[model samples]
Target: MDLIKTEKSIEDTNKTNNQIESIFTSFMENTLFKDKFVLQASYTPETISHREEQIAQIASILAPVLRGERTSNLFVYGKTGTGKTLSVQRVRNELLKRDINSNNLIIEYINCKLKQVSDTEYRIFAELIKKLGGNVPATGLPTGQVYNKFLELIDNEKKLIVIIFDEIDHAVNKITDNFLYNLTRLNTELSKSQISIVGISNNLTFLDEIDPRVRSSLGEEEVVFPPYNALQLQDILNERASRAFMPDVLEEGVISKCSAYAAREHGDARRALDLLRIAGEVAERNGLKKVTLKDIDFANEKIEKDKILEIVTTEPRQFQLVLLSIIDIVEKNERLKDNLSSSIFTGEVYNNYQRLCEKTKNDPLTQRRVSDILSEFDMMGMINSSVISKGRQGRTRQIKLVIPKALVPKVKKILIDAIHLS
Candidate 1:
């Protein structure tokens, strides 16, 4: 019996290997993508469409840098996928090209959304120093020491330094806005060199939230980028689609469907491009020659699931604990197979949350705080919450998980692993 079982296992392994090999062979033989990177976010076209005015404005603002003059600190605000980063990068590249003969101007860019590089003040300074050809120990040095090192490196010569901080608000959230004040004040301490800043944020009201002191020191010239409309999105999609896929690979209306979906997302061109790219992948996987409307729908569902899982992975411990408690309640109720809705009350979730906090040896937040987290989750579409009032008894929220039944197991596993729950 053992010999037969071992033989069967070997057969199954061989079958799996053959299946994988066949999939790879199919990918190589009949792929749809001509150049998939054309649909990627990083690919900068020679001429950016629908952003000419914004690009020209940014260029005019920074044009003084070409003549070794300190330009006004610029603040750029826009929603995601509004071509803010691409326009700024294009202008920066132009400045570099125009000033190639002189080493008097230096420009650097940092993405503050990256956790490892910008979660703390020290790491931000360290990353900047490293970019300027200086190295510091990753840790063990005081933040002030790291700041001094950066100042010394940049002030060693008579040059103008322009540092662009992308997603600057995210950095401020992790650290304080005092760093901005310190950075903007650097010019006063330097005798030969001057420093300028270009802050970019997806938050429309980011500047309003910062310290008034930092705001005054920044002295920023503001630029706002409006979201694209559906027609505009169609134009953008048409250009990228022509380059991203082989001719005749996309079924009719696929681009239109993608544009509509993205327009509903506030004209996010990046999301539209992602949809097109992923739909192509779905088609290729299904061994279909053309990307159809059905493929786009399937890709959308996949992206939604993946986006939720990503949120689960990145949320704070307390947020995860709260979500886990809700998931546990819903799952237990699911097993009972009651005819009623799976929705539970805020009180029940709080109770389960308290147990989880105890099990993990973490302090439990107040019911009010947990409810606030639940409201945030509702905004993120992870759950549906409603207020129900019972006269003098006051009111409570009716909560239900919005995560698809198919994703519950994966969500539970991630929560368990992240919280170290037994």
Candidate 2:
């Protein structure tokens, strides 16, 4: 008993000595961005904290009184990361706060960003319904049936249901538009749950592609949230600092610098917050007491590296090959035009690809896949393609790299380095 007591005392003392909560607390308090809306935990946040006007605008449009007339719908369009998702989420919360009856007011947020094909809409529809405790099946159901089931749940919610289709552009391809049309039109025939759709998209041209009938249904209201300016971003950072940080661990310049960078990227508050948090991490990794200007710079580089690689990884294999080939072509030619005919460009890509793999001693991918990738690259905005006749061969689509003719050298260098290093 005496030996055990001594051991326990020693162990407790050692554990106490090893613990560094007080020191770590300083780091934790300084950089944690706790804005629920901005962090987008449930949805996106009102990080800028002044979208109250927009939030109220969205809420007023879908006000509960509109339930009987099939919900009046809405569409929000803007560039990427302009707080569309976050704004819609803020409105959802506000709507729910106003004496929402679980059976009546049903708010569902579906991120179509991850769903691509037409059929996937059915899945998203089912998931949204399931989240609301609707009787949604596990799959194998017909699209019509699943859609009907989704409507049935909406009907049951019967008061005011606000559905947010976030990143709607990603899934706006030909096959998946059925769900969009139906959701807007569901109440035209029946009066169960009035649903007002709040579609959030980055593409300004998304509305042009929707069928006239769908557009008519979806044109209930439109509100565009502008990106934050640097001054606005700095204010946002200050607001967050009080709640998220502990002491003077965060420097004043941190907010300004992050704001400047984020402002340059269209004044995205989320980006600013991300930079600040990442800067703190860089500091922590380097065993620094607090994040500083140097750490922020390092974080910026890291963000750029990760962003570029992520952009590349998401590209189709053919596009990746095309990009890789362009890097090699620029290296060899020393001078390439901003736009070359697709026929000539494809030749360059194919030839350079062969040479690059040989020099790097890497196995070359087949040309068929390369062709497919190039097509996708064009589609995904990596390069441009157009049909041009090749004499007796008839019209064939030509391809060209859209990158600045001068910047091609740097882009090529980075891409090649990424390939061999990774």
Candidate 3:
């Protein structure tokens, strides 16, 4: 009798599994996405909108490589999400399409922010060597040997090579400008091949900080990418929306609102695209047939909250403690009903932070160090710090939380748990 009961249970479980599979398949068939990747930030469209002038300029600079002549090293500068990386990549794609049969050309792209690949001078050289079909271990080799192998590999090929360093500033900050100096100075030593570099950065002032010789060699020509205005952002969103969504899936005014919000925050095209994508996901999750303005608002809030959580979770413990101190002040102000604002002066925050450090059995950082951390938080958009002065009282920074009130409880909980764990 026990065996028979077990057999019946197995039959029921199989039936339930089949039903679950059928439900998932039905949902996939009904999703609003036609080609969802078109709305992704990494997807490069066949035709780029509103960047024709920039593309034409870059193409002209790189055009010399096709005729067996060396191209000038190029520097591209723009704010984040202003299309600097995409335009360069697009130009390179076009060049490769035209040079398909010309094995005499090679193009390599590296993002310096990538972990264990371009983070240091040795790792960057190791990556370049491996890309050229040469063998080099990720570690266990001296820097000089890695450089020699890279040079030898490049010298063997009688081809014109173009190497693009995206976010070159990160590498410079980590390992200094020596790597760039070496690459720029290498052209004279090569006998059989020619090389060019295209450096892309979001920081406009980075060039001024590098060695003058390195700067002159690396920046033969420079191009600046301007941010897209609201109308231009709208046009871009419309183009991608047509390809990404089913007919009439997006309600009226949805794209316009997303574009406007992003434009107000420095005209970031990536932000606009993210808003649209997340809105669609939210609508689909709610089983809605169309994405509406309400969905966009919800997505915006969710994205901001998630960004705050990410910043808080990844920050150093000291930074987290500083944030908690700010939170404690805000809570105290609320309870007192003193009619005074929640914003606290830096000195008071430092005192509270010290007390919290003692409670957690951690040595407190110096006041100057805490002030520096506060400045960093201000730069990161997590908090606002402004300098204020009273007559003969000198000057101090006034700090306030920038995140929404609703998020304070969540942040406080995380900080408490982290403090206990430590």
Candidates in order, TM-scores: namely: 0.89, 0.71, 0.92
lDDT of 2 by residue, 53-103 (tens): 777787677765434343467888766656677777766676667644544
- The digit string of per-residue lDDT tens for model 1 on 1-422 reads 45655778999989999999999999998899999999988899877899999988889988898889998898998999999999999999999998988979999999999998777899999999999999999899998899888889989899999999999989999887778888888899998898899999999888889999888766468888999998889899999989989999999999999999999999898999999999999999989999999999988889899999999999999999999999999988988995397788899999999998998998999999999999999999999999998678778999989998899899999999999943
Off by over 4 Å in 2: 1-48, 65-71, 100-103, 116-119, 156-159, 174-176, 314-316, 327-346, 354-422
lDDT of 1: 0.91
Q: For model 3, which pairs clash? A: none
lDDT of 3 by residue, 339-377 (tens): 476677899899999999999988999999999999999
Report the poorest 10 consecutive residues by lDDT, candidate 1.
Answer: 1-10
Q: What's the number of clashes in each of the models? A: 0, 10, 0
Q: Model 1: which residue pairs collide?
A: none
- Mind sharing the TM-score for model 2? 0.71
C-alpha lDDT values of all predictions: 0.91, 0.67, 0.90
Best prediction by TM-score: 3
C-alpha-based local distance difference test score of model 3: 0.90
